[model samples]
Target: MKKDSTMKRVLKLLKPYTGFIILSLIFALGTVISTLMIPVLEGRAVDHIIGKGKVDFSGLLFVLKEIAAVAAVTFFCQLFMNLINNHITYSVAKTLRQRAFERLLRVPVKVIDSESHGDIASRIVTDADSFTDGLLLGFTQLFTGIMTIAGTIIFMIRIRFTIALIVIAATPVSLLIAKFISGRTYRYFTQQSKDRGDLTEYIDERISLEDLVSQLGAGELSKEEFVKKNNKLTDSATKATFYSSLTNPSTRFVNAVIYAVVGVVGAFLAVAGSISVGELTSFLGYAREYARPFNEITGVITEMQNAMACAARIFEIIDQDQVEDCDGEFDGEVKGAVDMEHVDFSYVPEKPLITDLNVKVNPGEKVAIVGPTGAGKTTLINLLMRFYDVNAGSVKVDGRDIRTVSRNALRSRFGMVLQETFLFSGTIRDNLTLGKPDATDEEIIEASKAAHAHEFIRKLPDGYDTVLSPSGTLSQGQKQLLCIARLMLALPPMLILDEATSSIDTRTEMKIQDAFNKMMKGRTTFVVAHRLQTIRDADMILYMENGHVLEQGNHKELLAKNGYYAKLYRSQFMS
Candidate 1:
């Protein structure tokens, strides 16, 4: 589907903030009015002071005092405009951030995993910041600049209509200049935004692996690599900045020409006695005022180019296809029987992972899926969790087709522990209670003991309350233990363990297995393991290869058969 362009979407984002915008317009109006009156007042003072005989200081003084009053009004108006600017800018940025983050949460796991972590993080923060800084200030200046041009045109016409036409005629040239410059430069700004995102991702990746790099003693090598990336970023920025800088000076030149023309033409009319000296002065002032907005607008045009580039990226995320929503309702309580019927699946459709596959397990069965690397072990697990839907056919959990089940409702019945452990930044107790937020302290301890994590957790300074940073705060094995404890606390009707005990010591794995055996009486469990010994006692074992189940039986049956499973088992243990 064709998405709306960035400029159109950004204008749409401004709709909710209209009230703040209207208030800013009010302030802008006041500022422009006060500002335009200055030229008229100064023209009067000039005429009064330069009169033939008497200085007429009294009249000049009155004009000066009015000028002071208008200046004061202008100052207050500008101050209010700035306040309004901040309010609108910050509110818009906040809404964009919230929208981006909420979408981030609901996007498919595959989509989220495909992006660089740093690039995603930068879009939520750095891009939004640029959008706010550029658009807010630009809108503010745009409002005042446009109003100034209109007000000056009216005032100048009152002084002399022909000269006013002259001022208006030259305005389009300034616009033409802007259009030409921006066409050449806008793409560079877009490229610069992309390059900066890459740089952010590179730095973030480096920082995340800082400990490993330090241990490797490759700090200097890392520095040299970073400098190369930094140079690419710098070169792009310099090119973009160079072009945007041209906007102001080019417009200024056109404005200067307009100012000079008004002066010369008005001087000729003054000599012919067609207009008063005071009126001619006002006409010259209007000429300068008329061209000023174009100059300012071109300058803002440069900034808006960058802002529009940022807005485009934000829109790309907003417009991605979201994870499919489940519309089918299943009111029955889950009994944990599962079926994969004639399932066809693939991560990328061209390379099939499973073909016309079918599998069934009764309630409370201990099923182990054993396979070599790239044997579709984890992919099969993903289908059960509804992380990725099938290209053809369906999966039923407790006789309810999972595609019709809301992801939340379907996933709620399963507890999972994968090979890669993840823990949020919080206390160990807090992480344990995540699945069952209402779990009591005693419940936490029970689950931890089941996973054999309680002993080490108690030794920490604050016991279960000990805080953990995002990763590497605890040993990999300890992190894995916490994950198991979390799954135990949830006590879901079904469980999936994907190499869940790979990091644990043999002794610790034995204790956790005992806990699992005790809990497995009436609950269904699916274990994916490469360590054949881990699933030696599974009630039903399926040995798979190249996305097909080649064998199924208990461990002894497979070993006696002396097939592929037997060979893999020997490679790991019998050898």
Candidate 2:
């Protein structure tokens, strides 16, 4: 992205606080003016003491009191300026975080799946941290530095145009140093931010899959990989720091040159009749005041580069195209009939998952889809839910093209229990009632009983109110049962069990099968199962192979046909 774009986007976020910024600028102007006037007053006091060739006690006292009053006003103005600047900084940070989070909610599932959770999270957390820190310092330095520079130059020209030329000549040296250093380091800083995000993602993945890594004896390998990523981040950060470090000392050297030129030239001018001793003293003071902040400005420049990099990442996510709007508005009740006509899709367009697939189901039929791993089983579920759109053809519900239906309305009819169960960090009651927000306690208990989860839930310390985290101590089967119970309460007109009973033992599977039988009574159901036992009684069984419906019939009919279904069934149970 262009640097201007990044700058403009950040400024756009700050645009709403124009009035506040103006007020800050006013305060800042007062502080700078008050601060500059002090040296002038001090110079005049020096002139008075020397011109008299004796200490003028009362005159000195009045000068001292005037300087104190100006200093006091400068202090208050500086305080108010910082307060306003801090408010803008923190306000921008808060608003940026909110917008990014809201975009996270509205972003497509495809985008979410493509990006790691940690990278997105870093944009919200890590990037925001740098942004808040950098911006707080950036705006504060920028306003004060600009005002001080302009004010000093104007005052310096009035005092001595020749000395003023020296400061002006040295000014670009500081700017050029800042520019050159920032240019060299911006890319490294950007890379460092990305590498940091990758590290966060890696850590989260490692922790979540700790048991699997250890069980597979890949712990050392994973650690090596982590080290590699960590080194990349460290290297990028080192390079950024190294380049940015050059700015301050280099600019401070130019600052020293400016001071030297002013001193040497001012001494001659003071000796000759060209400038007064007091005027020369004030000019030197103004030069120091003007040049000192380049040191601070250079520091701000380093941080600004980092902040701009972070802001770019944030804008990248915020600027992503949102999910396609599901057009048309319909409140018609879904009767649960679904169809896929010549449907085709691929997560990657060059590698197809499903092609020319056609299927039909009546309003309340029990349908089972049996397939091997990677046979596009889950992809079918994604399509049906419109979590993704088909690259070609269409999936229809109740003879209406789903593409024409609003996503929320179409998805409202489906309640799914997947092989991988996910529970949010919340009370059991919260997870259970997600599908039916108004589900009463009695209804929740009944649903839990139907899914065989109530007995264990009641035995827990808090029963339905037991809070659960994603990494909570709940057993795999227990979590699955809770997921089932949650869906049972939902009781959508259509039901899906995608290897939902994988973790359950034979005895518990049988019990859940009974519950599934009860749950499937009034709903149009779809089951994707590896265990043949769960779907033996499905009204229609589809045997899929390599994304195609190779054969399909009732269980007995498929077995009678002596096809893949019968072979798959025997492979699991006949031994």
Candidate 3:
């Protein structure tokens, strides 16, 4: 999006806080009026002391008191304005962050899977922070600066119109300089934000896989890649800073010229007896006040440019196409009969993966799917779960199209345990009760025992209350066991086990396999496994290759046929 468009969207976010903004503007005006009074009062006091001998003491004393009162008013007004600015800054930032996160949850899973996770995180956290900083500066300085300039001009024109005209004529020169310099910095700041995201993504990716990097002895290589990204970020930041930094000094130079010109003209006017020394004094002060906002605004423009760039990145996520779900709920109990009719799907449209694939499995049947890597094994499971919709056909459960049902209702019926395990940073009880929050203690124990996790849980320092993180002390097999125990607690009518025992040892695998056999008795089960021995007793075995079911039959039948499944079966058993 363009800068102007991004700014308009940001303004919409602040619409709810218009009351605070109006109050701030009110105080800003009060501050400017009080500040303008000081110079006028000070000029009056100077006139009161006429060549030391002919002094107007009462007039001088009264002007000094007025100056003191106005100064106090200015301080209080400024203090209140600053408080309002801070409130507006952080509140808008919080709103943006909350909206960005809500969008993340609503958007399609493919949208998230396609983007860099670290970059998305940066936009929500780091970019929001930068935007707030710029916003705060704009609120505190930009508004006040503009007001001060206007007030100073009115005061100066009252004192002497000619001098005010000179200052006004030079005003556009300072503004043109600021605009020219600030315009060039936007692209640089944009590049800087992107580079920072790239660096963050690289760091998060490398750190998350530190164990693999160490095992492969690629630590040095990883460091080198990190350094490359870091250096690139540094270059972009330095260049952006270099360009933005020019605005302040450039405007300051033009302001100083205006200040000098005002002083020279005021002195000539004073000599000609057209204006008093007191009025000249006030005019010089007004000239300084008028020029000051130009400098401050130029600096604010620099930060505003950076803020707009970050905001554009944040809005990109918020504006993504959300995953659409129907309002339909299941009409009756789900019986786990699943069928895929002429289903076609591909991650990328140019390269088709699963095409016109068909599958059917009745309720209470144990179906095993075996395939090599990249043979669309996991992709099939994804289709069934409705993580991605089929491009050409329908996936049906209990003879109704799955897409017609709400995603939450459809997913809640299946219990799945995949190869990779994820444990939140909470007590084991919290993680176990996620799917069934109202599960009783007895039920938790029973599920744990069934998954062979109870013995290990009992050995922990706090049993089920022990906290666990993804990088906690638990081993891979232990975490996988906990995942199984979680599914057991839920006990959905259908099950999908995708190498669920891949992390466990042979002994544990045997025990878990027995437990799974008992669990699979009444429910329809789909098992995707690389180890052929684990699925020998399945009622039907599907051998898939390149998204097509090459052969499917029970162990005896496929063996008799001497097909692909038999060849795969012999490799594992006879090798």
lDDT of each: 0.87, 0.89, 0.92
Q: Estimate, for each residue in 1-575, the C-alpha lDDT of model 3 and write its tens digit.
A: 89999999999988999999999999999999999898899789888988958999999899998999999999999999999999999999999999999999988879999999999999999999999999999999998999999899899889888889999998998989899999999999899999999999999898889899999999899989889999999999999999999999999998899899999989998999999999888888888888888888998999999999999999998999888999788778888899989999999999999899888999989999998899999999998888888999889999999999989999999999999997899999999999999999999999999999999999999999999977899999999999999999998989999999999999999999899999999899999999988999998898998888888888899999998988888998898
- Which ten residues in a row are the worst by lDDT in model 1? 1-10
Please name the candidate that would achieve the greatest lDDT relative to the true structure: 3
Give the backbone clash total of model 1.
0
Give residue 147's error in model 2 in angstroms: 0.5
Q: What is the model-wide C-alpha lDDT for candidate 1?
A: 0.87
Q: Per-residue CA lDDT of candidate 1, range 60-104, in tens?
A: 999999999999999999999999888888888888888988888
Give the number of the best model, judged by TM-score.
3
TM-score of candidate 3 relative to the true fold: 0.96
Cα displacement (Å) at residue 3, model 1: 10
- TM-score for predicted model 1 compared with the true structure: 0.92
The root-mean-square deviation over C-alpha atoms between each candidate and the true structure, in angstroms, is 2.6, 2.1, 1.7
Candidate 3 Cα misplacement greater than 4 A, ranges: 51-61
Which residue pairs in candidate 1 collide? none
Off by over 4 Å in 2: 48-53, 272-277, 327-331
